[model samples]
Target: MIILGVDPGLTRCGVGVIEAGAHRRLSFVHVDVVRSSPDMSQDLRLLAIYNGLAAKIDRFAPDTVSIERVFAQENRNTVLGTAQAAGMAMLAAAQRGIPVALHTPTESKLAITGNGHALKPQMERMVARILGLNEPPTPADAADALAIAICHALRPAGALQGGEREQHLTPAQRQWAQAAQRSSGRGRRNADRGM
Candidate 1:
Protein backbone atom coordinates (compact mmCIF):
# COMPACT_ATOMS: atom_id res chain seq x y z
CA MET A 1 0.00 0.00 0.00
CA ILE A 2 1.12 3.55 -0.69
CA ILE A 3 0.49 5.97 2.15
CA LEU A 4 1.13 9.68 2.31
CA GLY A 5 1.70 11.08 5.78
CA VAL A 6 1.41 14.73 6.75
CA ASP A 7 2.75 16.53 9.78
CA PRO A 8 0.86 19.76 9.56
CA GLY A 9 2.10 23.12 10.76
CA LEU A 10 1.62 26.72 9.72
CA THR A 11 5.30 27.37 9.14
CA ARG A 12 6.46 23.96 8.03
CA CYS A 13 4.23 21.06 7.06
CA GLY A 14 6.09 17.79 6.67
CA VAL A 15 5.03 15.41 3.93
CA GLY A 16 6.17 11.82 3.44
CA VAL A 17 5.17 9.04 1.09
CA ILE A 18 5.90 5.40 1.78
CA GLU A 19 5.15 2.05 0.21
CA ALA A 20 4.42 -0.84 2.50
CA GLY A 21 4.24 -4.50 1.57
CA ALA A 22 3.30 -7.62 3.44
CA HIS A 23 5.53 -8.91 6.23
CA ARG A 24 6.05 -5.42 7.72
CA ARG A 25 8.36 -4.22 4.97
CA LEU A 26 8.38 -0.49 4.30
CA SER A 27 10.19 1.68 1.73
CA PHE A 28 10.39 5.42 1.47
CA VAL A 29 9.05 7.04 -1.66
CA HIS A 30 9.38 10.73 -0.87
CA VAL A 31 9.83 13.09 2.09
CA ASP A 32 9.90 16.88 2.34
CA VAL A 33 8.73 19.90 4.33
CA VAL A 34 6.36 22.43 2.81
CA ARG A 35 7.27 25.78 4.25
CA SER A 36 5.51 29.13 4.50
CA SER A 37 7.13 32.28 5.79
CA PRO A 38 5.90 33.56 9.15
CA ASP A 39 5.66 37.00 7.61
CA MET A 40 3.10 35.84 5.06
CA SER A 41 -0.58 36.50 5.57
CA GLN A 42 -2.49 33.72 7.27
CA ASP A 43 -4.66 33.14 4.23
CA LEU A 44 -1.65 32.93 1.96
CA ARG A 45 0.10 30.52 4.31
CA LEU A 46 -2.90 28.27 4.37
CA LEU A 47 -3.18 28.47 0.62
CA ALA A 48 0.41 27.40 0.26
CA ILE A 49 -0.18 24.46 2.55
CA TYR A 50 -3.30 23.44 0.66
CA ASN A 51 -1.65 23.75 -2.73
CA GLY A 52 1.49 21.95 -1.66
CA LEU A 53 -0.46 19.03 -0.28
CA ALA A 54 -2.73 18.92 -3.30
CA ALA A 55 0.26 18.79 -5.61
CA LYS A 56 1.81 15.97 -3.64
CA ILE A 57 -1.42 14.02 -3.70
CA ASP A 58 -1.64 14.42 -7.44
CA ARG A 59 1.94 13.44 -8.01
CA PHE A 60 2.22 10.48 -5.63
CA ALA A 61 -1.29 9.14 -5.88
CA PRO A 62 -1.24 7.57 -2.46
CA ASP A 63 -3.75 4.90 -1.52
CA THR A 64 -4.47 6.83 1.66
CA VAL A 65 -3.49 10.03 3.38
CA SER A 66 -2.55 9.92 7.05
CA ILE A 67 -2.27 13.15 9.01
CA GLU A 68 -1.14 13.86 12.54
CA ARG A 69 -4.17 14.71 14.62
CA VAL A 70 -4.14 18.16 16.22
CA PHE A 71 -4.03 18.34 20.00
CA ALA A 72 -4.93 21.22 22.30
CA GLN A 73 -1.99 23.16 23.62
CA GLU A 74 -1.50 25.83 26.26
CA ASN A 75 -0.62 28.17 23.41
CA ARG A 76 -3.94 28.67 21.75
CA ASN A 77 -2.47 30.43 18.72
CA THR A 78 -0.13 27.57 17.97
CA VAL A 79 -2.90 25.04 18.35
CA LEU A 80 -5.15 27.03 16.03
CA GLY A 81 -2.54 27.19 13.31
CA THR A 82 -1.86 23.48 13.56
CA ALA A 83 -5.55 22.74 13.36
CA GLN A 84 -5.89 24.88 10.25
CA ALA A 85 -2.93 23.17 8.65
CA ALA A 86 -4.42 19.78 9.41
CA GLY A 87 -7.71 20.89 7.93
CA MET A 88 -5.93 21.84 4.72
CA ALA A 89 -4.50 18.32 4.53
CA MET A 90 -7.90 16.74 5.06
CA LEU A 91 -9.46 19.05 2.50
CA ALA A 92 -6.92 18.13 -0.14
CA ALA A 93 -7.43 14.42 0.46
CA ALA A 94 -11.20 14.77 0.50
CA GLN A 95 -11.20 16.70 -2.76
CA ARG A 96 -9.41 13.80 -4.42
CA GLY A 97 -11.67 11.16 -2.83
CA ILE A 98 -8.73 9.65 -1.00
CA PRO A 99 -9.29 8.00 2.35
CA VAL A 100 -7.80 9.89 5.28
CA ALA A 101 -6.61 8.79 8.73
CA LEU A 102 -5.65 10.93 11.68
CA HIS A 103 -3.06 9.54 14.06
CA THR A 104 -2.03 11.06 17.38
CA PRO A 105 1.60 11.91 18.09
CA THR A 106 1.75 9.39 20.90
CA GLU A 107 0.32 6.65 18.75
CA SER A 108 2.85 7.27 16.01
CA LYS A 109 5.71 7.40 18.49
CA LEU A 110 4.68 4.11 20.03
CA ALA A 111 4.35 2.46 16.67
CA ILE A 112 7.74 3.63 15.43
CA THR A 113 9.82 3.62 18.57
CA GLY A 114 8.07 1.22 20.91
CA ASN A 115 7.37 4.04 23.41
CA GLY A 116 4.55 6.52 23.55
CA HIS A 117 6.82 9.26 24.91
CA ALA A 118 9.85 8.67 22.76
CA LEU A 119 12.10 11.69 22.25
CA LYS A 120 12.40 13.33 18.85
CA PRO A 121 15.93 12.07 18.26
CA GLN A 122 14.96 8.55 19.20
CA MET A 123 11.94 8.65 16.94
CA GLU A 124 14.06 9.96 14.08
CA ARG A 125 16.57 7.18 14.55
CA MET A 126 13.91 4.53 14.48
CA VAL A 127 12.35 5.97 11.32
CA ALA A 128 15.72 5.96 9.62
CA ARG A 129 16.37 2.36 10.56
CA ILE A 130 12.91 1.23 9.59
CA LEU A 131 13.16 2.79 6.15
CA GLY A 132 16.81 1.72 5.84
CA LEU A 133 17.96 5.28 5.29
CA ASN A 134 21.55 6.21 5.98
CA GLU A 135 20.31 9.26 7.89
CA PRO A 136 17.05 10.37 9.39
CA PRO A 137 14.84 12.50 7.19
CA THR A 138 15.91 16.11 7.62
CA PRO A 139 13.91 18.41 9.94
CA ALA A 140 11.93 16.89 12.79
CA ASP A 141 8.66 17.43 10.95
CA ALA A 142 9.68 15.19 8.03
CA ALA A 143 10.53 12.36 10.37
CA ASP A 144 7.20 12.84 12.09
CA ALA A 145 5.36 12.54 8.79
CA LEU A 146 7.13 9.29 8.02
CA ALA A 147 6.29 7.99 11.47
CA ILE A 148 2.59 8.60 10.94
CA ALA A 149 2.68 6.58 7.72
CA ILE A 150 4.55 3.76 9.44
CA CYS A 151 1.98 3.70 12.21
CA HIS A 152 -0.90 3.13 9.83
CA ALA A 153 1.13 0.64 7.80
CA LEU A 154 1.68 -1.44 10.91
CA ARG A 155 -1.97 -1.65 11.94
CA PRO A 156 -3.77 -4.98 11.66
CA ALA A 157 -6.05 -5.27 8.63
CA GLY A 158 -9.05 -6.04 10.81
CA ALA A 159 -8.62 -2.80 12.67
CA LEU A 160 -9.46 -0.92 9.49
CA GLN A 161 -12.49 -3.10 8.74
CA GLY A 162 -15.75 -1.45 9.72
CA GLY A 163 -18.49 -2.69 12.07
CA GLU A 164 -17.85 -5.07 14.98
CA ARG A 165 -14.17 -5.49 14.16
CA GLU A 166 -13.65 -1.76 14.71
CA GLN A 167 -14.61 -2.23 18.34
CA HIS A 168 -11.30 -3.93 18.91
CA LEU A 169 -9.30 -0.86 17.83
CA THR A 170 -6.96 0.77 20.29
CA PRO A 171 -7.96 4.14 21.68
CA ALA A 172 -5.82 5.99 19.15
CA GLN A 173 -7.08 3.87 16.26
CA ARG A 174 -10.65 4.46 17.39
CA GLN A 175 -10.01 8.20 17.36
CA TRP A 176 -8.66 7.91 13.82
CA ALA A 177 -11.74 6.03 12.71
CA GLN A 178 -14.01 8.62 14.27
CA ALA A 179 -12.14 11.47 12.61
CA ALA A 180 -12.35 9.76 9.23
CA GLN A 181 -16.10 9.32 9.63
CA ARG A 182 -16.51 12.98 10.53
CA SER A 183 -14.46 14.01 7.51
CA SER A 184 -16.61 11.96 5.17
CA GLY A 185 -19.75 13.37 6.74
CA ARG A 186 -18.49 16.90 6.24
CA GLY A 187 -17.78 16.15 2.60
CA ARG A 188 -21.31 14.89 2.13
CA ARG A 189 -22.70 18.00 3.79
CA ASN A 190 -20.58 20.21 1.54
CA ALA A 191 -21.77 18.38 -1.54
CA ASP A 192 -25.37 18.82 -0.38
CA ARG A 193 -24.73 22.53 -0.08
CA GLY A 194 -23.25 22.52 -3.60
CA MET A 195 -19.87 23.53 -2.39
Candidate 2:
Protein backbone atom coordinates (compact mmCIF):
# COMPACT_ATOMS: atom_id res chain seq x y z
CA MET A 1 0.00 0.00 0.00
CA ILE A 2 1.15 3.53 -0.76
CA ILE A 3 0.93 5.78 2.28
CA LEU A 4 1.67 9.48 2.53
CA GLY A 5 2.56 10.73 6.00
CA VAL A 6 2.31 14.44 6.70
CA ASP A 7 3.68 16.73 9.40
CA PRO A 8 1.66 19.84 8.80
CA GLY A 9 2.98 23.35 9.34
CA LEU A 10 2.38 26.67 7.62
CA THR A 11 5.97 27.42 6.66
CA ARG A 12 7.58 24.01 6.93
CA CYS A 13 5.29 21.12 6.21
CA GLY A 14 7.07 17.78 6.05
CA VAL A 15 5.87 14.90 3.91
CA GLY A 16 7.00 11.33 3.42
CA VAL A 17 5.78 8.56 1.15
CA ILE A 18 6.35 4.89 1.82
CA GLU A 19 5.14 1.54 0.58
CA ALA A 20 4.41 -1.42 2.78
CA GLY A 21 3.76 -5.04 1.92
CA ALA A 22 3.76 -8.56 3.27
CA HIS A 23 7.49 -8.84 3.85
CA ARG A 24 9.10 -5.43 4.22
CA ARG A 25 8.64 -1.70 4.04
CA LEU A 26 10.17 0.53 1.37
CA SER A 27 10.42 4.31 1.34
CA PHE A 28 9.53 4.85 -2.29
CA VAL A 29 9.65 8.62 -1.71
CA HIS A 30 9.94 11.42 0.85
CA VAL A 31 9.33 15.19 0.79
CA ASP A 32 9.81 18.18 3.10
CA VAL A 33 8.32 21.64 2.64
CA VAL A 34 7.24 21.89 -0.97
CA ARG A 35 7.90 25.58 -0.49
CA SER A 36 8.90 27.91 2.35
CA SER A 37 7.96 31.57 2.14
CA PRO A 38 7.53 33.54 5.34
CA ASP A 39 6.55 36.79 3.67
CA MET A 40 3.23 35.44 2.48
CA SER A 41 0.04 36.50 4.27
CA GLN A 42 -1.80 33.95 6.46
CA ASP A 43 -4.45 33.27 3.86
CA LEU A 44 -1.88 33.01 1.11
CA ARG A 45 0.20 30.69 3.22
CA LEU A 46 -2.74 28.37 3.74
CA LEU A 47 -3.59 28.41 0.07
CA ALA A 48 0.04 27.73 -0.78
CA ILE A 49 0.00 24.75 1.50
CA TYR A 50 -3.25 23.57 -0.01
CA ASN A 51 -2.00 23.95 -3.59
CA GLY A 52 1.40 22.43 -2.91
CA LEU A 53 -0.18 19.50 -1.13
CA ALA A 54 -2.69 19.07 -3.95
CA ALA A 55 0.21 18.73 -6.37
CA LYS A 56 1.84 16.17 -4.10
CA ILE A 57 -1.39 14.22 -3.96
CA ASP A 58 -1.48 14.25 -7.74
CA ARG A 59 2.10 13.06 -7.99
CA PHE A 60 2.11 10.33 -5.35
CA ALA A 61 -1.43 9.04 -5.79
CA PRO A 62 -1.30 7.71 -2.28
CA ASP A 63 -3.93 5.20 -1.18
CA THR A 64 -3.85 6.47 2.37
CA VAL A 65 -2.72 9.58 4.24
CA SER A 66 -1.41 9.53 7.80
CA ILE A 67 -1.32 12.71 9.86
CA GLU A 68 -0.18 13.57 13.35
CA ARG A 69 -2.73 14.96 15.79
CA VAL A 70 -2.06 18.59 16.66
CA PHE A 71 -1.26 19.01 20.33
CA ALA A 72 -1.22 22.48 21.84
CA GLN A 73 -0.43 23.35 25.41
CA GLU A 74 0.02 27.12 25.59
CA ASN A 75 0.30 28.53 22.09
CA ARG A 76 -3.14 28.86 20.58
CA ASN A 77 -1.74 30.46 17.43
CA THR A 78 0.54 27.51 16.80
CA VAL A 79 -2.31 25.09 17.36
CA LEU A 80 -4.70 26.90 15.04
CA GLY A 81 -2.11 27.26 12.25
CA THR A 82 -1.25 23.60 12.54
CA ALA A 83 -4.92 22.64 12.38
CA GLN A 84 -5.33 24.75 9.26
CA ALA A 85 -2.30 23.21 7.62
CA ALA A 86 -3.61 19.82 8.60
CA GLY A 87 -7.05 20.63 7.29
CA MET A 88 -5.61 21.51 3.91
CA ALA A 89 -3.63 18.30 3.80
CA MET A 90 -6.81 16.40 4.63
CA LEU A 91 -8.70 18.27 1.96
CA ALA A 92 -6.22 17.03 -0.60
CA ALA A 93 -6.81 13.48 0.48
CA ALA A 94 -10.55 13.91 0.79
CA GLN A 95 -10.82 15.27 -2.72
CA ARG A 96 -9.40 12.02 -4.03
CA GLY A 97 -11.46 9.85 -1.63
CA ILE A 98 -8.26 8.48 -0.17
CA PRO A 99 -8.34 7.23 3.39
CA VAL A 100 -6.76 9.55 5.98
CA ALA A 101 -5.59 8.38 9.38
CA LEU A 102 -4.69 10.47 12.43
CA HIS A 103 -2.16 9.34 15.01
CA THR A 104 -1.24 10.90 18.31
CA PRO A 105 2.41 11.54 19.15
CA THR A 106 2.18 8.91 21.85
CA GLU A 107 0.69 6.37 19.47
CA SER A 108 3.37 7.02 16.85
CA LYS A 109 6.10 6.79 19.44
CA LEU A 110 4.73 3.53 20.81
CA ALA A 111 4.35 2.01 17.36
CA ILE A 112 8.00 2.73 16.67
CA THR A 113 9.72 2.46 20.04
CA GLY A 114 7.49 0.14 22.10
CA ASN A 115 7.10 3.03 24.52
CA GLY A 116 5.19 6.27 24.43
CA HIS A 117 7.86 7.94 26.57
CA ALA A 118 10.43 7.55 23.80
CA LEU A 119 12.73 10.47 23.11
CA LYS A 120 13.04 12.10 19.71
CA PRO A 121 16.35 10.38 19.04
CA GLN A 122 14.78 7.06 20.00
CA MET A 123 11.89 7.58 17.58
CA GLU A 124 14.34 8.58 14.84
CA ARG A 125 16.23 5.35 15.42
CA MET A 126 13.02 3.32 15.32
CA VAL A 127 11.83 4.93 12.11
CA ALA A 128 15.22 4.25 10.54
CA ARG A 129 15.13 0.63 11.63
CA ILE A 130 11.60 0.12 10.28
CA LEU A 131 12.32 1.68 6.89
CA GLY A 132 15.85 0.26 6.69
CA LEU A 133 17.30 3.75 6.43
CA ASN A 134 21.05 3.93 6.86
CA GLU A 135 20.66 7.16 8.86
CA PRO A 136 17.94 8.97 10.75
CA PRO A 137 16.20 11.84 9.01
CA THR A 138 17.11 15.42 9.89
CA PRO A 139 14.82 18.30 11.00
CA ALA A 140 12.78 15.89 13.17
CA ASP A 141 9.75 16.78 11.05
CA ALA A 142 10.53 14.10 8.49
CA ALA A 143 11.22 11.59 11.21
CA ASP A 144 7.86 12.45 12.80
CA ALA A 145 6.11 12.07 9.47
CA LEU A 146 7.76 8.72 8.93
CA ALA A 147 6.66 7.62 12.37
CA ILE A 148 3.04 8.50 11.53
CA ALA A 149 3.29 6.42 8.35
CA ILE A 150 4.74 3.48 10.21
CA CYS A 151 1.86 3.59 12.70
CA HIS A 152 -0.80 3.04 10.05
CA ALA A 153 1.28 0.68 7.97
CA LEU A 154 1.65 -1.62 10.93
CA ARG A 155 -2.02 -1.44 11.87
CA PRO A 156 -4.68 -3.64 10.29
CA ALA A 157 -6.35 -2.21 7.23
CA GLY A 158 -9.59 -0.35 8.01
CA ALA A 159 -8.61 -0.57 11.62
CA LEU A 160 -6.06 2.15 10.92
CA GLN A 161 -9.05 4.52 10.81
CA GLY A 162 -9.65 7.77 8.94
CA GLY A 163 -10.01 11.33 10.13
CA GLU A 164 -13.69 11.35 9.22
CA ARG A 165 -14.36 9.17 12.26
CA GLU A 166 -12.50 11.46 14.66
CA GLN A 167 -15.57 13.54 15.40
CA HIS A 168 -17.54 10.46 16.31
CA LEU A 169 -15.11 8.94 18.80
CA THR A 170 -16.46 10.46 21.98
CA PRO A 171 -14.73 10.74 25.34
CA ALA A 172 -16.97 8.07 26.81
CA GLN A 173 -16.03 5.61 24.10
CA ARG A 174 -12.36 6.31 24.62
CA GLN A 175 -12.60 5.85 28.37
CA TRP A 176 -14.51 2.60 27.99
CA ALA A 177 -12.12 1.20 25.46
CA GLN A 178 -9.12 2.08 27.58
CA ALA A 179 -10.61 0.58 30.67
CA ALA A 180 -11.56 -2.59 28.84
CA GLN A 181 -8.13 -3.06 27.34
CA ARG A 182 -6.40 -2.49 30.62
CA SER A 183 -8.61 -4.98 32.40
CA SER A 184 -8.21 -7.56 29.67
CA GLY A 185 -4.44 -7.27 29.72
CA ARG A 186 -4.36 -7.41 33.50
CA GLY A 187 -6.46 -10.57 33.50
CA ARG A 188 -4.25 -12.20 30.92
CA ARG A 189 -1.12 -11.38 32.88
CA ASN A 190 -2.66 -12.69 36.09
CA ALA A 191 -3.70 -15.89 34.38
CA ASP A 192 -0.14 -16.37 33.15
CA ARG A 193 1.17 -15.81 36.65
CA GLY A 194 -1.25 -18.38 38.11
CA MET A 195 -0.12 -20.97 35.60
How close to the true structure is residue 46 of candidate 1, measured as C-alpha lDDT? 97
The predictions' CA RMSDs to the true structure, in order, are 7.5, 9.1
User: Would you list the clashing residue pairs of candidate 2?
Assistant: none
Tens digits of lDDT, candidate 1, 1-195: 899999989899999999998889999999999888899999999999999999999999998898887866526778888889889998998788777887778878878887899999999999999999999887766988999999888765654434223344666886887688677764233222210
Candidate 2 regions with alpha-carbon error over 4 angstroms: 24-28, 72-74, 156-195
Report lDDT per candidate: 0.82, 0.74
- Model 2 per-residue lDDT tens digits across residues 1-195: 888888878788888888887765566467566554779888999999999888888898988888877755626767778888889988898788777777777778777788989998888887887887788876666778778878877754454322324423565774665577577664233222211
Q: Per-residue error at 129 for model 1, in Å? A: 0.8
> Which pairs clash inside model 1?
none
Query: Using alpha carbons, what is the TM-score of model 2?
Result: 0.76
lDDT of 1: 0.82
